[model samples]
Each structure stands twice: as C-alpha cells, then as structure tokens.
Target: MIEVLYFAWVRERIGVPRERIETEAATVMDLINELKLREERYAWAFDDLTSLRVAVDQELSGFDAALAGVREIAFFPPMTGG
Candidate 1:
C-alpha cells in the first residue's frame, strides 16, 4: 500500500487529506490514472497535470517517475515564491 497525500485545493476537491491505496501502478502517471478512475473528484483534482507538482517519499519528482518500492506519494499545486 502507498500513502497518498493531497494538499491545498487537491485536498478540498478530493474530500480527504490522505489515504493509503493499494495499487498495481508501475509509475506515478499510472497511479494517477487509477485515481482518476475512482471518482469524478479525483479526475477534477488531477485534470491539469501542468498545474500540479508531485513528490515521492517527500522528494520532488515527475509524473513518469517509477513507483517501484515507493511508500508515499503527494500531490499539490505548484508553489510560488513570494
């Protein structure tokens, strides 16, 4: 199981802050596809990948990042510096 965390508007849209998901996805993009299939909320939250940023095990990563042996994944909007 991988711990999936949603932040900011993503959390609001998904109606949850985090969840443990059992998945067979081989990559982060694949995992996102699984999420989008689960509900409309997920699809809405993930609709614009360009506006989102991802992390695997607290380290920044890309959508195509491999999910092999990953224990955590986080999704949030791109951060802007003040």
Candidate 2:
C-alpha cells in the first residue's frame, strides 16, 4: 500500500487530504494514470502535470521516479517564493 497525499488545490479538487491505495504502478506517472482512471475528481486534480509538484518518500521527485519500495507520495501545487 502507498500513502498518497494531496495538498492545496490538489486536495480541494480531489476533496481529500490523503488516501491509502494498493497499486501495481511502477512509477509516479503510472500511479497518476491509475488514479485518473478511478474518477473524474482525480483526473481533474491531475489534469495538468505542469502545475504540480511531487514528492516520493518525502523527497522531491519527478513523475518518472520509480515507485518500488516507496511508502509515500505527495502532490501539491508548485511552491512559490515570496
């Protein structure tokens, strides 16, 4: 099982802060594809990969990052500096 966390507008669109999912995805992008197939909410939240940032196991990562042995993944809008 993987712990998926959503933050900022990603959370608002998905209507949840987090969820635990059992998946067979091999990479972060694959996981997003799976989620997008689950519901429109997920699709909407992940519609634009350019507007988002991702973390794997609490460290910043890319969509192609391998998911093997990963325990957590988070999605949020790209951070902005003041």
**lDDT of candidate 1 over 1-82, digit per residue (tens):** 9999999999999999999999999999999999999999999999999999999999999999999999999999999998
Model 2 agreement with the true structure over 1-82: per-residue lDDT tens digits:
9999999999999999999999999999999999999999999999999999999999999999999999999999999899
TM-score of 1: 0.97
Model 2 C-alpha lDDT versus the unseen true structure: 0.98
Best by TM-score: 2
Where does candidate 1 stray beyond 4 Å? none
Model 2 per-residue lDDT at 36:
99
The TM-score obtained by model 2 is 0.98
Per-prediction tally of clashes? 0, 0
Q: Each prediction's TM-score against the native?
A: 0.97, 0.98
In candidate 2, position 20 carries an lDDT of: 99
